[model samples]
Target: MKQQIKHQYAGQYSQLSTKDFNYIKDHLSWELLAAKKCAHYAQESQDPQLATLINQIGLMHQRHYNTLLQYVNPQSVQD
Candidate 1:
């Protein structure tokens, strides 16, 4: 039989419902993908200012990704 993994979220409740968990997982993926896409476009950009702006946008997405990751697995998160 396949095993199921459980998650505990921070705040008032320790556990998330299946729907909420799935949403978080999906959101996490979206954030990571956005970050990667931004980075790729930034590298492909020839304009210095545009590249910088894209890089900054990528950083924002990356930060959101990481924060969501921490919530999903706080134990693995490093200081």
Candidate 2:
């Protein structure tokens, strides 16, 4: 009998495919770039308010990166 593929928002699966890994990799790359850019601009800004906003943006991106990273390696949660 042939198996079926089920799509879900959240669930545990026995395995992940190469395409899934590649998608995660691409998203991680984008998050990294966004974080770096926000940080760099935040440092370069002269206005205090703008700097604060940029810093917040950077933090958000960093959080996203961390979340994605955790998804990539669930074992790290124990560390």
- Candidate lDDT scores, in order, read 0.86, 0.79
Who wins the TM-score comparison? 1
Provide the clashing-pair count of each candidate structure.
Answer: 0, 0
Stretches of candidate 1 off by over 4 Å are: 1-13
lDDT of 2 by residue, 1-79 (tens): 3343333323665445677767887998999999999999999999989999999999999888888877777555443
Model 1: per-residue Cα lDDT over 28-48, one tens digit each = 999999999999999999999
lDDT for model 1, on a 0 to 1 scale? 0.86
Query: Model 2: number of clashes?
Result: 0
Off by over 4 Å in 2: 1-14, 76-79
Which candidate gets the maximum lDDT versus the true structure? 1
Could you tell me which residue pairs clash in candidate 1? none
